[model samples]
Target chain A: MEATLGIEGGATKTTWVVLDAEGRVQATGRIGPGNVSLLREEELRALLAAIRTETGGQFHSIGAAFAGCHLAAQRERIAGLLRVFWPSAKRVVVAEDAHSAFAGAFGSGEGIVVIAGTGSNVRGYREGRWARAGGWGHILGDPGSAYDLAHIALQRVYDAFDATEGLVPLGESFLERTGQKDLEELFVYIHSDPSKDRIAALAPCVLESAAAGDRFAVDVVLSRCGLLADQVKCVAEKLRFDRPKVALVGGLFEHSEAYALLFEEQVRSRLAVSTVFVSRVPGAVGAARLADEAAEEHPGVEPKPSRILLRESATSLDGALTEERNPRSRFLDRKSVPELVELFLAEERLVEEALRERKEEIAAADRKSSYAVFCLKKK
Target chain B: MEATLGIEGGATKTTWVVLDAEGRVQATGRIGPGNVSLLREEELRALLAAIRTETGGQFHSIGAAFAGCHLAAQRERIAGLLRVFWPSAKRVVVAEDAHSAFAGAFGSGEGIVVIAGTGSNVRGYREGRWARAGGWGHILGDPGSAYDLAHIALQRVYDAFDATEGLVPLGESFLERTGQKDLEELFVYIHSDPSKDRIAALAPCVLESAAAGDRFAVDVVLSRCGLLADQVKCVAEKLRFDRPKVALVGGLFEHSEAYALLFEEQVRSRLAVSTVFVSRVPGAVGAARLADEAAEEHPGVEPKPSRILLRESATSLDGALTEERNPRSRFLDRKSVPELVELFLAEERLVEEALRERKEEIAAADRKSSYAVFCLKKK
Candidate 1:
């Protein structure tokens, strides 16, 4: 029996759907954090197995879109994994989740898409060329994103407490939310590996309060939306798009209408020509479409362009590029592709280290590990 | 602003009640398995803290009744702990949980009471004298207890799979429950510490099938009940109360009426008991009542009894004593109590060894270090 599998890897959740030839989902499986930047390859494979179990078997072809998986190297790594998991399959396709969100939002057309969950990013496409905005680490950017909103709200709450010299009612509320005793503890918690994302998720609750006329919280939300608009503006200006069509695709948009509307108002107010639209089709469906496109483009490649067996040559080229600095080339081109790739690879390592630290903090959490997982803040 | 605290410690749960001096419970706390045979004194303190957190605070004049708290040395150790927790309180009482159950069942009167949860035991009282039957360690006894039923079920399931000389349906079912591929994997998991308790819990689910009259499961339950009845018979025969009043307590009574009726009928058929009663008052309450009695019996004693505290001590002691040679003679025997107490001083080296082993396990638990006052079990 022929099957099509679509996987959507998010900062907080990895969702996958198995469809029969007719494109109707037979089963769906959901788990947390599948981005290789955040999860080990073995962890990703376990998630795939969970999907397979939910689907009842292996599929004929698969399409997977991942957050923080834009690099060509990651695509090849995933392709190899798919081959092992689906040896008899016809094809496999792997790509950046932005592409999936873009397709889901605008199909084959040119447009920009914004996604915000534990992390946030904006991507623009024009005739197969890609440009991007925001999604810098939590320390630098991600305004209007869940992480951005949460970060801002936490600061404001702390600021208010500090302003009152710790006499503020909100200090107790924050303590209740994080289960920490004071600012020092909260700092340790935030910087600790696997930082709590759910604490940041409370940004929406704060946003809701602001919408209900809580001036302090509303200011936090407004500032967050303004920052997100500025990020989108930066991408549009760089790409030289007169009136780039904007599409929103993420939990930040799908779950919160207030945040979406506020973001749209801010972006349109800043840029005259752009029109933002939220995507109706999910990212997984977009991945499925991309898989179909890849198969169409490369029809007769050995093992098929879209199919991969996970067991074949279990290692990949990424293993070779470790810390043996290309000293000669480091002096050659400062902004070369190799340099960019190395930076991402280094970032992946940093992210892994951070996640490990987060895991330790959460491992000590009694009975509710999921809550710790939910609480993790993605940069 | 003053309060009265009551505690009852049994095989299954150590319960604590804080009342506002009017005998109305202000807060209630429950902890499982207060048997000193299983928990070290330090482990007991942690359990007490858990109950204290649940109960909200310290209270005046606490009463505690503990299981397996027979020896004078054990009582003195418990007395010291109560004094520390309730120093400002007017009174503290400590006694055996059986007496409290007796009071709750047939207050201030003679009767027989059977208790079962993780372990099973029967206690009979006639004119202030008490006798106990069963409640040995899981390896030695504990028939009609959840632990015994669970143990038997596990063995049957294992034996059934082995008899097939390969994989059986039961093996497949067990694999499904544990998400394991086969018996070999299951066996490895069964040996894992946390895994044992999780698998044992599944046994009760199997008992539900037996209650519905699955022949194999029925036999398991009946055999367990028979063992329980035998324990009760030992105490009843010794007390020589022909037509003695009997009361039932614990999880077995609460969960399965059929099992309880069968046990009652078997006891009646064998021992010619006139009245069989089920106690609605919890064992913790009974323990508290006994604690009250103890403090009153010995006034100006610094330590006051706490229902939840002593049980925690008992559990900690049990975990500590697992590897130690029987020191029953050191603590038992009233005539030699002074000599034995002096020997304890002489054998301070042995006590030190036990404390080290306990510290190792606590360290291995790898969480926050806990505080405890007594050391009974070692590595």
Candidate 2:
């Protein structure tokens, strides 16, 4: 019996399932916080070991969907890790979450898949090419994301309170909730840590309260939905797929009635998109199918790892460290200017400048001093 | 019978309840993210109405924990809002969360409270006076917060991955979770959003994986714990709190099993006169009680707010908004010389000279400019 494997990895959790060739889930194991970037080799190995032990059955092939696993080096390292454990398994493949999400949404053909979870991103697949929009994290990007909508609402409400504008029920509710004696405390709280996404998560409750007839809460919700619609417009523009069958995947779209209604209404009103998919499909399922495709095409060919290997790979999947340059690990190695810039920027001086606007002035001054003589006379 | 209210309001969520004065939670209702700074007046009024509906009983006197209520202006606004709602409530008072947490811990006495939730702050209170350490945002501070821990882990793992150091399991796991494909992808993800607290939340998982023998994860966790301990020690040293019982509050310390243990062990090992108290007392309870204390002590006294209402507060919360100030708003406000210097220093032009490595060359250029000015004056 060929053992089957299923993997569900997300920002919050990672789950793996072993299935027989017939597709019955034979064994399943779960691990905490499975984003590989956040895990160490020992932890990864331990998690992998847990799965390997639970499944026991040696599988003929392995398919994995990694959260944030779009890089080639990451795929190679993951493949090497799987190769160690399933030595007999001829094929191991990894692909972007978007690919898997696309597959899960349309199965085989072309369509647009929008993922809105803790973060947000939209991917369009046409003519075997993929174009992505948004998902730029909760900061600079993530336009129509839950975090974005919630952040905008919160900011507007806060602005109203600061202005001492007329009474808003949600603002009053906010005062009651924070238990802050006044505006000063609220500002401090907002200034403190400031998780816009976490704040955004509470958006659903606001919408619910509004639908139940709280004018203030409703206003906030409407404002939030409008902001989300604006973000969707940006993505639609980028992908150039107007009126495409858009599948909505994320807790916000799935749960919030007010937001969903408002979002759909706004999209129809604002953009000339043909179809809006309200279908629920997991990104993980999409990721799994993408892996299956990669495996079929590549067969036994595992790309060389670029420069980084997972901790899990060290112990179970990839096995012993090679003092010499291992052919398999080479694919994980590549250098980029931006990557180098990031390193240089890590120095305290650069980090300080990045953190504070004024610090850049100081850095510029120091630069001028060093180059003053050089400018006067060629170096 | 007087109504009793249970309110839990922070930067994240808000809750309000009413019970008889005998202290039984009666009716309960929750509204969406209610930070006053983020709400409009309409939203505030609507949300407050919902709370009133949930109570179903008249609140003779109510209590709440509010976020960013530390400012005098904010306090007056909240008082005004509350007055509008429960007109005949015998009394109302507001105070800071530090005071609330202190009261919750000692109930009117003095102790140390270390909070490590979305942000990290340590406050030492003794006989009404308070001292604080490290509650800056992810941009500046939050040394021991979950965000801080996660940020440090990301940095370390990335450094290790890039370095020629022997690969570890934690490194591998990190790669698996991030799916960076390679260094370039990893760089992009790190630069995206790059929240310190979200990163800190991932520490526990690293700790868990490390304990199971993920060496890389273990190293990261140990280093993070060390940083946290250092933060506690820095505050302890600054304010000579001899054998003070440091009450640990916040999700990071409360939820992470080994993290608390490791933190406590590290602190004890380093400080000769320090005791760590893992308390169950919630900050909200403390905040409510603090409000009661403030009400009792102040009697009928209420602050007369400055004239600078919301219209004049159009800039960022850090007091950058000067464009909207009217004569009335600017009436009593005066900037100190030091404050002016600080503001001036914030200008991008002034700080550039200091950025260069050769300060003397810049100084020479300045001297030449001064000489030219002299010559111009002579002419």
Candidate 3:
């Protein structure tokens, strides 16, 4: 029988599920990562082949939401790959994992979704106008991600070690958990590894310390959560949703109740949000829903793939001169040398006019300046 | 026949002055720039030769204060070069221009001196102890320098051009003074000529606009002056000088009464300074005074050159581990695996003991957590 297939692919793993027209789950499978941006063309083909083997039954429609598919180019590449794999399928849809998460949380409605797992990002939607803020990768700006939380905890450990007083108990516990002999060894380990997920794995220790009344740990978590809340608020304002519903997605908020509660409280205190809740549906299920909705909306017609290229060439002065709209200099190229001289004289006259208009103000400033008067008298 | 020679060598020009033992100026000469850091070894030798020719009869002593002589190594290099140039001179002194400026203003007493010219730096002297702040070169720090001021003004012009509201009068003045057709052409000009002094030349326009009541210009100058004040305050605190005397040096302060007045007001308002005045004594004259003082103090013996090496090797993880004083990890290398396991177990036991000590606090935190209880109940 005809069925719709949904795939949720990330950096670590891929989940695939098949559902019949009535939304009944017919089959399910799991495999390694299929994030198109991280995979080579051959590796991506291998992943698609593996996925095709699992969801091999007759499929009328398919939707694949993959991690690292934030850019339109990435989404189009994934869609093109799916088209090659399942050419006979009536419709194939590809989107960023955020789109599936948004659909899963609010079902194509107006809201904001914040993902704070290994990395953090915020997406807001209002009547088809989508806006995003604070997804600047791990090195620059992930404020409330697990990696951020763990990194801040490690920084505190170093701070405590360098303080005039000895290490605090919270810092001592971080040392114990990591099997590190001291802060020096911890620095060595951090320098050697520098892996985002490996660093993120230490966030649990920070939460535990905060639960045990470590003031430093609590402050770290609270401040990071505040930053996350600010990201949501910024997206909400950009989308101009007065009281948008916000959904917190990702393992950090889903598994850690203490962190989730703190994050929710911080977000609500800062933003006039309508509702804030943890998303229960997985991204795979959201993909299936989007597929079903796309099939119903298009009714046998396939959607066009994204053609907009996002990346632009680096800026140069010549390019800037040609591109920038400057009304004052617009007629310079058409003018003769004598005309240019006249224009230059006119511009010089404008400066004189501006200065003349401000003569009284300048005189007033001179009169009020006791020091200037004193210096002039000395001269 | 016995005359002391003093030279103030900087990025723009070098000033050489010959003074008698009674502090009367006997001769004065000016030459090209001789900043040791900016010059080749041959170029520096030539500049020294030119100065020696100007003060040919120098017999008692010589002092040279050169720009870019901040480090002890630079000072020693300058002193060695002086010894070669005037071998029979009774004493040869070399110092950073800041030192001579400080001596000029305070007469070898305790005080703080701020030099705000093409670049900015702060020097503090307290009971023979010297301290410094901010002067981390142009790319890193120099926040209150004329280069910094002009650079920020240019940045604001671009910002206004990109902004929807369009350019302010301050930005207009900047564009006019630069003689650029538009912001795009200005960008081209800036990229073509990245000279620090050329960029610093635009600072007068900023000050002029600020005096003419441009709010943006006023803010920029105020903020930069505030940064200069902070540098002074930081140096003063580091040297532990209460109500320190302050000397403002450099051509920026000497030439611009408005900027100098505002800077003094901002500094005094922020710091409990005893006195603030511009140094009327040129750096070359201060160098002459230092030469005379050195001859009197040493009588016949020449001072040994600076021995301090400025550069250190880059930090490595292995170096850090070996250098850090951690008593607990000192004996780990001698322990076997079984002994290490035993040590690990002991550390684990310490964690348990520490947790046991805070058991009541942890229990109280758990009991008081209304959100945690809800989460646990939901689970």
True-contact fraction for model 3?
0.00
Model 1, residue A193: C-alpha shift (Å): 7.7
User: Individual DockQ of the candidates?
Assistant: 0.01, 0.06, 0.01
Off by over 4 Å in 1: A1-3, A19-27, A50-61, A88-91, A166-194, A295-379, B1-379
Q: For each of the candidates, what fraction of the native contacts does it recover?
A: 0.00, 0.09, 0.00
- Model 3 gets an lDDT of 0.63
- The CAPRI class of candidate 1 is incorrect
- Give the C-alpha lDDT of model 2: 0.50
lDDT of 3 by residue, B1-379 (tens): 5677878888888887776664555667778997766788889989988777767744677878877665555667777878787888877777767766665555556678888888888888777577776554453356678988887777555534433336677767767988976554555466445577778888998887765656677778878888888778778877888999787777677656556656766787777876565554556766655665553433222222211100000000001111121243345335543343234223444535544554454334312333322332232
Model 1: per-residue Cα lDDT over B1-379, one tens digit each: 4566677665566767665543344556667777554568887777666766666555656667677665455666776676666666566666656556565555455667787665666777775566676544333356777766766665555544433335544345556777876654554455333222464455555455554545566666767777777767777767777778777776576455445555665675577765554444555545544544343545323222233322211111212212222343224223232232233323445555664656554333211111110110010
Candidate 2 per-residue C-alpha lDDT over B64-109 given as tens digits, one digit per residue, 9 for 90 to 100: 5555444566656666676677666655555445455555555544
| lDDT tens digits, residue span A292-348, model 1 | 445342222211111121111111111111112124323323443223323322344
